[model samples]
Target: MNPSSPDGHYFSPEPSVASDPRVVDVLLDGVDLQLQSDAGVFSHGQLDEATRIFLDGVPSPPAHGNLLDLGCGYGPIALTLATWSPGARVYAIDVNERACDLTRDNARRAKLDNVHVSTPQQTPADVVFDAIYSNPPIRIGKQALHELLATWLQRLAPTGVCYLVVGKHLGADSIAKWLTSQGLRVDRLSSKQSYRVLEVRRTDREQI
Candidate 1:
């Protein structure tokens, strides 16, 4: 879903496209939200189908703990998690500064104080996530995607879980195999609309 824009890729640190902001109306878990979106970010105008499916399928987040929304675009997943778990601290991380700014603005507009919008490097190094949700930028290429996942997955709490939605055509099964090879436990939670929703956890927690 992260195709190159006229100026640069959506993953670019600073997108070169002119600002074109808009309000996106989204309904998650029966909660209505008006989020600020703009050009140069992923799914600028509306919630993409993959994310819609991912949100609809994932289980309820932890009641209170550190949560992460990786590759957060315009704060849809991050804001939704904040709405769902008001007590949780939601870290919304992205590489695009424009996207990060949009997320911060949207969070402020929604009055969700629990969300922390930042670039990956800006996230506190000592924080461990209780849960992570992502509709990753698979188009970033396999090596980059692998590195990105590895970095964050390592930050998962011992008993933490990461829920991801990847398209079947985009090699969801292969990613599961790769995660398994890395000594993580991967389960296909559901398959809908050619997308695979994966539930991942540390294998060491199996005995617990």
Candidate 2:
């Protein structure tokens, strides 16, 4: 999760802090990876607990389809998805340009060409995701978080599913109810360490 910064939040389009890069080692799906991270981004020096739990709880991604790593901070989720599903396209999007750059560099370092790193606006509008995995920015406040989820959740393919890990204290249950009110099916896949893993699917063929 992104901590508050004196200059700006990690969600800022451009962070004001100077870059202090570091390498973060992450083990996902029993595969070890060394990725690049930097200041002014979420979990800069290491994998945050929420993301680690998220990775552990979620199932393997689709073998060949468009996959989305929403709010991808420094490429952990996106890289793992790309690594495991070489046939699939992994889109890693974040509002922070620094985060996007790091994800791009990390993807290159990992030699995963299938991962596409971009800002939310830079992503192609025509593309639809087969699955979306995220540890959403819950601290962005309830309204902004709701808007962000609504925007992307609408982009899910008819049968697409979204797996999100949110802290129970952060209102995971409330978010699930809100998603359901938006005409999506929400299921609690698991809960660990005060975090809830929610599986969201469109209730109908129509866009939510």
Candidate 3:
């Protein structure tokens, strides 16, 4: 397990929190959701603003296909995807074992059988996703964040798209430029509350 800070390390492999789980309620698409969260994960006290904006900006996923919630801290994005796209297989990948544990229980509580929570290494390398969503871990540092994006972005299907939200103060523009330079099409879907909602697609074909 990667060494972690117990207070709140979304990327922690093994969080040391004493298992004080809390229930959080969030409304999405007019439906109420109760999620289990704890101290060791990201934004455990409430749904972070960036994620709420991401959810508001990205529409319901495709009805049937593979979907990924990268850095799925306690499964908000993953669970939402599972609930919104019942036919799709939603994979929630997180390094923090406690976050994964919370997500698993949350999914079960929600009666969602389509969620698969695991560490990145446990995910099948051969599987590709139709769409991916995240409010990425910006504090993870530029090099590490770039590598994280590259590892999974490469697994996107030819026509796949990724939706992300990053705070402007967190260098959103820099990351967008970097992504474009790497041969992906980057577009700003919205900017609100100092956050940028970015939509990325592979430049697999030349534009006319």
Which predicted model would earn the best TM-score? 2
Estimate the lDDT of model 3.
0.87
**Residue-wise lDDT of candidate 3 within 1-208, one digit each (tens)?**
1225434466778766566777888798955789988877888869888999889888779889999999999888999989888999999999888889889999999999999999999999899999999888887889999999998998998898999999999999999999999889999999999999999998884321
Q: Write the per-residue lDDT of candidate 2 for residues 45-75, one digit (tens) a residue.
A: 9999999998888988899999999999898
In the range 32-104, model 1's lDDT, one tens digit per residue, is 8999888889988988999999999999999899999999989999999999999999999999999999999
Please give the lDDT score at residue 162 for candidate 3.
Answer: 93
Stretches > 4 Å off in candidate 2: 1-7
- What ranking emerges by TM-score with the best candidate at the front? 2, 1, 3
In terms of lDDT, the poorest run of 10 residues in model 3 is: 1-10
Model 3, residue 165: distance off in Å is 0.5
Clashing pairs in 2: none
Model 1 scores a TM of: 0.95
The TM-score obtained by model 3 is: 0.93
C-alpha TM-score for every candidate: 0.95, 0.96, 0.93
TM-score-better candidate, 1 vs 3: 1
